[model samples]
Target: MSRKLLLKAVEQAYSDRRRLVAPLLGFPGINLTNSSIKVAQQNYIEHYKVLNALYNEFHPDAMFTLMDLSVEANALGCYTLFPQEESATVLHSSFDESRLEFMNSIEIEGDSRALSYCATVKKMSENFQDSMTCAYITGPYTLAGLILGANKAAEMTLTNPELLDDVCGTAYEKIKTYAEMLTSSGAKAVCVLEPSAVMLGPEQFIRFSAEYVKRITEIYSESDIAFIYHICGNSMHLLEAMCDAGVNALSLDSPETGMDIKKACKSAGDNIIVIGNINPAGKILYGTDDEVFNETEKLLNETAEFPNFVLSTGCDLPQAVPLENIRAFMDAGRKYKLP
Candidate 1:
């Protein structure tokens, strides 16, 4: 599809009388298929099974691929761990500038895991025409954090800003290339996950994370590919920078993490979509069906007045989250009427 048709799909979804329900599901959905996260991450057929399972059961307005922050780092030679049933995790490595030549020389699209995700995106576009297809990319600062250990990345911020800036420049280029791969593979909506940037104050966040994010979104400025920016923890102070980053939407954390979703939506105003606020680890994971329904309905009552809001979990649900709980969340969202 051309970019205009993709933009039309999203616009029609948003304009519908009902609010769109799209949970940031990845591993939890894999449980429906006879597959593990490790297998799905490595094999495209297995990944499409997960996507099919989620769409068959929950029928979200949009479908997001498995959320893995390790793709770019793993492609660039960072040490990564792949648990049998969990998403891959990148280990902290000491930043050594001498290694930049080798890392920069490596082509990320050649990576097996990166290729698996691209194939999954292409499959989603081909197989699932009714639902919007979305994917995730590691944010520049987060990728830089993986390149340099988190503590070192933060220390270099004030101690050696020049070196840190250079590292982030490398990260920005890598992320841009990966973005091109995903977009070319047929991902209509791509999210830049910047979980590691939550620790920095607003000023540091804009300089280290948001600015590069702006540049990444510029690649599709004329097309409505739905660039979404997501941070893992509370980002109350960084809402200004987040809204100014030129993304079409913001996936915020749960109120339990000290993020007031109502306030976040107000800050986003009418232009940007607010995709979340439900605690991934809260009621939906531990409470009864009634509890999850009440929680979902309560959030809708509070924030559905904003036409741009989409009902979703704050972050990806854990693999252990019971399937019945997800049904409860979806049931609540589907039953509610938009204000």
Candidate 2:
């Protein structure tokens, strides 16, 4: 399909206030492999299959592939291994300051692990190009957690400010590079998954996370692809900072109140799009399809007239979430009409 047609499809969906579906339909506990560095090579194909399957089954307007978070960290020499039936985990925690220091020299495209992510994104774009809104994940501060150790990194934000800059800066550059690659490969938008950003106080979030995100946003501002910042925790305080970071949209967790988010957005002059606050774990995952639809209806009503709003869960849908609930989400989107 032509680029114009692809863009038009996405635009029409947004203009009609249609909720675009993402590949995050599976639950968090679902298995993600990390057997070897070489396994990274196959990450794209494996994830693509899941996405393809989901697309075939549901036929959503858009889709995304789940790449292991440790992809970049693994390439940077961090020891990470995947366990059977469990998500990828970092086996070792020691940050080689030397590696972090030389991060600027690292080439994101050629790095073994980073390349795998890029390849997976490319394959998704190639296969689902015109039909789906392709997406890639860059778990921002969470990536920092893998490299610096979450506790130590949080401490450094307070105790060693300079080092924190280096860490975030390095991670930001890598994420920016990866984001560019994904867009070039045909992603309509890239979601920066910054789940750990919520762990910091507002002050710390501003100091440590905002600028890094800003740098990336600035780089992609003119591109056709949109940028969304996903924070899977209470993000009330950092809402403005996230907006300032140049994100085109925000994805909030179910724990966050939609009223609070709307208020914050209003205060920020409604600068960015708001995607979600559905309780995926409690309501969508465990609840029945009717229950899911009811919850979705509540959100749709509450967010009415809020341009650029998209219905979604607080975070990625868990693997164990009832597929019926997933269908309910899509069904609601299709059935919804503005009054």
Candidate 3:
């Protein structure tokens, strides 16, 4: 399908409150068994079938690639081990800043896993050709966390600003390359997963993360592919900086970032979409279906004035989230129509 049609369907589905099912569509912090992860990789066709079944049951309009963190990090010199019955974990880093000179010389694609991720993008494109398939790229800031260690990166932001710049720059280059690969491989949109930027104050976020994000989005600005920036914490302070980054969409976790996002988008005169503020863990993951439906309705109603909003969890749905609860989200989307 054309990218135009894909986006239109997504908008229509959301507007009419129709369900749009996308696999690995958004982050769900829920853990999957190693076996499930392996199964997802080895039998994608089969996995697509399962996703289709869910979509059929729920009547969602789009599909997303299964969630996997191995792609970008592994490409940039991180190792991930998928445990059979446990959550996948990063086992090691290829470059450590303590040895800054050595890390600087390590090229992104020079790492074997990066090549594998490029291949995965091709495979996923072929697998989800009929639906709107979104490819995930680690946000430069988030990738910095993986490379420098979240705690180390946070500390360096204040104590060693230069080091923070070096680390973020290196990771941004790698993520930009990966984003290009995914877009070329037919991803309808690229979701920049920047959960860590929320940790910084507004000034720090602008200094450290905003420019890198802008750099990435600028590369894809002329393309039909969408650039989505997801900041998982209370980013009310950095909302304008994020909007200025030139993303096609801004995803926030709840409680609402308020009129700042609406005002920022207006100020920029850019048609950026807004997504999510639902409590993925608390409401969607563990709450009753009724709770999910009610909360979703509340969010939709509150954001109804915004034409480009997409309803979604504040973060990823837990791996073991009740399928029924997920269905409730879709159901609520279909039930709430804009006036």
**Top of the candidates by lDDT:** 1
Estimate, for each residue in 156-248, the C-alpha lDDT of model 2 and write its tens digit: 877887887778778888877777777777677777888778878877787677778777767766655677788766788788788878777
Each candidate: what lDDT? 0.86, 0.67, 0.65
Model 2: how far is 51 from its true place, Å? 0.4
Which TM-score value belongs to model 2? 0.86
Worst 10 residues of 1 by lDDT: 1-10
Kindly provide the TM-score of model 3 when superposed on the true structure, using C-alpha atoms: 0.81
- Global CA lDDT of candidate 1, please? 0.86
Number of backbone collisions per candidate? 0, 7, 16
- Please list the residue runs of candidate 3 whose C-alpha ends up more than 4 Å from where it truly belongs after superposition: 1-35, 38-59, 91-130, 256-270
Task: Provide the RMSD of all predictions against the true structure, rounded to 1 decimal.
Answer: 1.9, 4.0, 4.2
Tell me, by TM-score, which candidate is best.
1
lDDT of 3 at 278: 74
Measured against the true structure, the TM-scores of the candidates, in listed sequence, are: 0.95, 0.86, 0.81
Q: 24-118, model 3: which lDDT tens digit per residue?
A: 34322122222354555334444455444544455444455555555566555566676753434565454556655554556665554445445
